[model samples]
Structures are given as C-alpha cells and as structure tokens.
Target: MRRRLSEYGLFFRECLRNFHATGAIVPSGRFLASALARFVGNGPAGGQQILEVGPGTGAVTRRIVAQMGPDDQLDLVEPNDRFVEQLRQQFETDPALQRVAERVRVLHCPVEQLAHGKVYDLIISGLPLNNFSVADVQGILAALTGLLKPGGTLSFFEYIAVRRARALLSGRAERARLRGIGRAIGAVLDQHEIRREWIWPNLPPAWVHHVRL
Candidate 1:
C-alpha cells in the first residue's frame, strides 16, 4: 500500500515536471494496464520477446511482468530518468519483479532514440499521442511499428475524448494540432487495428488500441 502510494507520488511529480513526456495525471489504472498487457505471453514454442515504451514507474510494467511466461523477456524503454530509476529499484526489491528480474532490462531512452536491431513479438506503449505534434506522433508510431516482428501486435492507449475536451478550451492553434493528431492516429487504426478495449475505470477513461503489421 505504501509502495503504491509512493509510486503515485513520483508519477504525479513527474507529470508536473514534464507533462508532455510523463503524459497522464497518474499511473495507469489496473484495468487499463491489463488491457495493454493482454498480448504478453509465450508463443507456441515459448521464448516471446516483449517491449514496453514509456513505462512510467512500472504501473503497466507490473501487469506485463505478471503476464510474462517463463521464457519471455521484457525490455522497458523509458525517457524519464526518475521513472527509469524507480523501475530499476522495483526489479531489485519488488517480489513479483524479482521473479523475472533476470529477464528484464530497463533502457533509459525514448523509443524513437533506441538504436537496436532487436524486434519484438509484442510492444505496449504508454505514450501520450495527444501531447505531441502530428509529425512526432507519426514518427513515434512508425518507429514502434518497425520494432515489431512479422504479425506482431502493438498495444497503445489514448484518453477517451481528450482531444475533444481540450479542443473546446484550447486556442485555434491547439485545436488544429489536436485534429492533426487525430487524423494521424485514425489512419493507423483504420488500417492496422486488431482490437480495441475501452477501460472506463481509469483516471479519465481510456481506449487501448491493439494493432498489427
């Protein structure tokens, strides 16, 4: 209980310090994390590789780690140094994470800047697309897509009706930016979306979009 509260405090501080990168007001709710980690598993012959981007303080990371098979490996890519430190500490102390600590690694970098040839069977993202420019979101999405193996799935979430709500209060420039982001996201969902999960119990409600190549 104390640990969870502390994690939330850290997340909240990160939000105030860097809302654009930290994204949400708090860590993802359990339901939303579960939906995002739904694809984490061992394949027919075992040994599935998973990648999680923007795993702030390991909210969704816990769910993903809980779902990982014996032979599964997870790489967490986080841009925030404090979040990365917290994640490392969790693996060192948290009982559940300790179980698969050997199979997990935390990378201190953005997904866009991660330079590696490794591809994953499943990729879950906690990035806030609505906070970025259209080009930035498109680039980030493209990079995530490129990191997946053939037929691999990518699960990411967007807050429900966030753009609309913000657009109502934002200036014309902000509204146009929001619309551009919507169009960029819509294009991907229209073509590659495999499933959608609506999680209403989250902070402000959210939709997890699962897509494939």
Candidate 2:
C-alpha cells in the first residue's frame, strides 16, 4: 500500500513536470497493465526480446517482469530522470523484480535515439501519442516499427474520448494537432492492427492497440 501510494506520488509529479511525455496522472491500473502485457505470454518460443518505451514509475514494468520467462530480455527507454531512478530502485529492492534484474537494461533516452539494427520480438509503449505533434508521432512510430523484428508485435494505448473531449475545449491549433495525430496513428493501424482492447477500469478509460509488423 505504501509503495503503491509512493508510485502515485511520483507519477503525479512527473505528469506535472512533463505532461506531454508522462501522459497519465496516475500509474496504470492492473487491468490495463495486464492487457498491455498480454503478448508477453504469447511470444514465440525459445526466448523473446522486449522493449518498453516510456515506462513511468514501472507500473506496467512490474507486470511485464511478472510475465517474463528466464530467457527473456527487457530494455526500458525512459527519458525522465526521476522515473528512471525509481525504476532502478524497483529492480534493486523489489523482491519480485530482483530475480530478473540482470535481464533488464534501463536506458535513459528517447526511444528514437536507441541504437538501431537490434530488433525486438515485442515492444510495449506507454507513450501518450495524442500529446505529441504529428511529425514527432510519425518519427516515434517509425522508430518503434524499426526496432521490431519481422512479424513482431507493438502494443500502445490512448485514452478514450480524448480527441472528442479535447476538440470541445481546445482551440483551432490544438484541435488540428489532435486530428493530425489521429491520421498518423490511423495509417499504422489501418495496416498492422491485429487486436485492440478497451479498458474501462483505467482512469479516463483507454484503448490498447496491438500492431504487428
């Protein structure tokens, strides 16, 4: 309970400091985390390489750790210094995560800057796509798909009703930005969406998109 509350506090602070990057005011709910990590169990045999982008406070990170096999490897890309520190501590101190600590590497940089050519079997993104500009979203998406192996899976989420809600209150510029993001996301989904799940239990509700490349 205390740990959970502490995570929430950290999430709240980061959200305030980088709302566009942090995306959510709170850590992902268990239901949402489980849904996002669904592919972790269905991965191809032998072993799997996974990349998690924007892992704020290690909420989904913990869930992924729980689902990881002994041979699996996880690489976390988080630009926030505080969250990176917290994630390192989680692996160091959390009993459930300590066993797999050696399998995880926490990289403090944008996903786009990560070394290329190394492909992942699965990529789970916690980025708030809606908050970014169209060009940024496109570049990020390109980087994500680039990191994935052939037929690999990429999972990410966006809040439900966000576009409609923002459209109502946002000015012309903001509204146009949201629509541009939609088009960018749509282009990817139209081609590669294999599955999508709606999690109503999460704060403000959310939609998870599973794309294959």
Candidate 3:
C-alpha cells in the first residue's frame, strides 16, 4: 500500500511538471507507451539505429532501450528543456543506457533541425501533430523523410482530435479538415512509396504512419 501511494505521488508530480513545460497535458494513461514498445519489438532487426522525437518523461525511451540490442543506437530529439532534463537524469545512472550512452544522443531542439547527416534505420515520433499547422507538419515530415535510410521506417502516434477543442473550442476546425491533413500527409508518403498503419488503442487512439525508404 505504501509503495502504491508513492508511485501515485510521483505520477502526479510528473504530470504537473509536464503540463508546465509543454502547455499540453501529460498522457492520462500508459497505452501509447505500450503501443510504441510493441511496434519497436516487432520491427525488423536491420533497424538498428532508432530515432525518437518528443520522448516525454522517458516512458517510451525506457521501453525502446529495453528492446534495443547492444549494437543498436537510440537518438532522442526533444524540444522541451524541462523534459529533456528529466530524461537525462532518469538515464544517467542506468548501466544498460550507460553502456550504450555513446550510441544515445539527445538533441535539445525541434525535430526539424536534427542534423546527424546519416539516415536513421527507424524513427518513432510522439509529436502532437493535431496541434500543428499543415505547413509545420509538412516541414517535419520532409525532414524525417530526409533522415530515413532506404527501407527505414518512421512511426508517429497522436491524438485523434481535429482541433484544440479543449483549449479553444471556438477555433476548432471541421473534423473533415483534420482528416484532410492526415490524408495529405499520407499522399506525400505514398509518393515516396511509404506505407502507413493507424492504431486505435491509445487514449483518443492514434494514427501510426510507417514509411519505408
């Protein structure tokens, strides 16, 4: 009973911390983390270099590291300073992570500015696409594609909402408009022969876009 209470307190504190940092609420459940772990575990072994975008609170990172082999590398691209600090502290004393720390690189910038020059074997994105503009999404997609190696995969999970109804119910666009954005992104990837998969297990569910280049 005491352990459970301690865990709940930690969760609450983390949620409040995330809220203050991103202006968005922390995830209410662990479904998305589980989904991402399952996806990584089922992916091809050749995808040794993994790139994660927006690893809030290191939930997915912990899972990714667990699934990764010794030779595998994981790169984290996060824009939130507070979350980044949290990630650094979380993994700092971890031996498994330390053994491969050289292989893990954390960037304190937006996903669009990552400049490793080499393409990644797999990219897992947790960015809130529904909150971004079409152009913003396009730029991010373009950058991601540019960073993907031939036959590499890029996956993303996001809320299904079309607009910021909870925050600004008045500025919300039509649901069709939101779907249009998703379709547009799909079309761009199809042009490059990238396949996509959508999953509905997350809170509000999510669309997981997978592309092979």
Mind giving the per-residue lDDT tens digits that candidate 3 earns over 112-142?
A: 9888697778888777665566677778888
CA deviation > 4 Å runs, candidate 1 = none
Compared with the true structure, model 3 gives a TM-score of 0.74
61-118 per-residue lDDT for model 1 (tens digits): 9999888889999999998989999999999998989999999999999999987899
RMSD of 3: 4.4
lDDT of each: 0.93, 0.92, 0.67
Name the better of 1 and 3 by lDDT. 1
- Candidate 2 collision pairs: none
The 10-residue segment with the lowest total lDDT in model 2: 38-47
Query: Model 3 residue 86 lDDT?
Result: 60
Q: Looking at candidate 3, what is the lDDT of residue 207? A: 52
